[model samples]
Target: MSTPVVLIHGMWCTGGDWKRVRDLLEPRGYRCHAPTLPAHEPTADQPLRVGDRSLREYRDFLEQYIREQDFRTPPILVGHSMGALLAQQLAARIPVFAAVLLTPAAPWGINAAGLANLAPFARVLGRWGFWNRPYKFSREAAAAYVYNGLSPERQKACYERMVHESGRVAYEIGLWWADWGKTTSVDADAVRCPVYVVSCGADRLTPAFAVRRVAGLYPQATHRHYPDRGHWVIDDEETEEMIHGICGWLRPLEQRAARGQQAPR
Candidate 1:
C-alpha cells in the first residue's frame, strides 16, 4: 500500500480544488487529504492578508495536522504553485517521506528572479480592465491558459465552470514572493527529504525555468519537464499519464520500505 499523501493548494484556492486529484490517487491505495488553509475559504469571516500569515504558520498547520491525525507514516506533501514552495519548507522542518512540487514558484530568498513581484500590478490593471480585458478569462484566454492541455470540448466545459479568484490574494501573493526570504521563502539546503518537481511547459503563471531552479536547489531532487501541459496539469487530458508517472516514481520507494531498506533520500 502507498503511504498517505497531503495536498496543498496555491493562493486563493481552497482544498476543494484538489477533489479530482484526490479521487484519482486514493483508488491506488494511497490515502489523500487536502487540508484547507486557515483563511482562504470563501466562507471565512475574515480573509488572511499578505503579512497576516507567514510560510512558517502554514507549515506549522500541516505539522499539527499530521501529528494529530496519526497518519501511517510521514506522508508525501504534494503542493501546487505557492503551496509547492510551502511544502518544501514543511519538509525541512518535519519528517516527511517525500515531496512533489508542481510548477513551483521560485523561493523568495533569491532576489534575481523578480517577476513575481509584479503580480500586484494585476490589481491596478484589473481596475482598468487590462488583465480582465485582453486576457480576461474569456473563451480565448481560457482556451490558451486554463484549458491549454485539455481537449477543445473539455476546455470549453471546464472553463464554463471556472470561477473568479480573489484579487486581494493575488496581490498578496505578489508581496509574499517579493518578500520571500525575509518572510515566505525556505532554505533549500535545509530540506533533506526526496523532492520531485513537475514543470508545466505552457504555464503562464509559473514557467518551467522557475521549476528547474528549484530542482537545482535540492540535494535529492528530480525534475521532469512536461512539454505540452499548462499550470492546471491535473485537468489536462494527459493527467492520467502524469499520475502514472508519479506513481511509478513513488512505487520503488514503497517497495524499498517493504524490504526494510531505508527510504530513498
Candidate 2:
C-alpha cells in the first residue's frame, strides 16, 4: 500500500482548508488525512478559548494523531504556515518518508520580520484580554495578508469560511509574551527525511525571503518559489499548477519508499 499523506493547515483554518488538495491527491491512489488541530474546530461541546493554547499543545495533538494511525511507513507530512512549524518539529523526532512545507513560518528563534505587514493587527498581542479569546481578522486584512492573488469575489468567499484563530498561537508566532522554552524548535540536522520547501513571493504573512531562509536551514531541502503566488497558493487560481508541482516532487520520494528504501531515521 502507498504511504498515507497528512495535510496540516495553518492558523485561521481547519482541516477543511485542505479539501482541495485532498481531492486532487486521493484520485491518484493516495490516502489523505487532514486533522483539525486543538481549538481549531469550533463545536458546541468544545468552545474555542485560544488564549490558553500553546505551540506545544498543537504539536502534541498532531503527534498523537499521527501515532494513532500506525502506518507501515511514516506518512508524508505536508504543512503550511504554522502547520509547517509543527511538521518541522515532528520530522526531527519521528521517521517520516518526506515533508513539504508551503510558505512555512520560521522556526522559534528565527526573526519573523517578513511578517511586518501584519503590523496593523499588532494591538492584539498587547491586549491581555485578547489572550484567551478567539481572534478573527477583518476581511480586508485577510485579503492583504493571504488572498491578495485571488479575485474580489473569491477572496470574500474565502474570508467567509475563516474561523477565529487561537490568540495564543498568534502571540506565540509573533513572539509576544510567549514561553521560549516551550515553543516549537527545529533541529535541521536531526531531520533526516527529504524535504521540499515551497515559497510564494507575494505571501505577506510568511514572505519568500523568510521561507527561503528556512529552506537554507535544511541542507538537503529542495526549494521552489512561485513569484506570482500569494500565501494561499494552494487555493489560488493557479492551484492546479501548485498541486502538479507538489505531485511532481513527491514522485521520486514515493518511488523510493515503494522500493523498500526506508526513510532516514
Best by TM-score: 2
For candidate 2, lDDT tens digit of each residue in 1-265? 7559999899888899898888788887778999998877756433355546877898889899999999877888999998898899999988787889989988876776744556646766667766566677788888888789889998998887787777667767776326557475788898888898999878888888889989988987989998988889768787777778888878877777668776433
Candidate 1 Cα misplacement greater than 4 A, ranges: 44-54, 110-121, 124-181
RMSD per candidate (Å) reads 4.7, 2.1
How would you encode candidate 1's per-residue C-alpha lDDT over 96-186 as one tens digit per residue? 8889998776676433233533443444445642222212255766566455677788877766554444443343344454443455567
**Total clashes, candidate 1?**
0
lDDT (C-alpha) at residue 103 in model 1: 78
Relative to the true structure, candidate 1 reaches a TM of 0.79
Task: Measure candidate 2: CA RMSD.
Answer: 2.1
- After superposition, which runs of candidate 2 have C-alpha atoms over 4 Å from their true positions? 44-47, 176-178, 262-265
Q: TM-score of predicted model 2?
A: 0.92
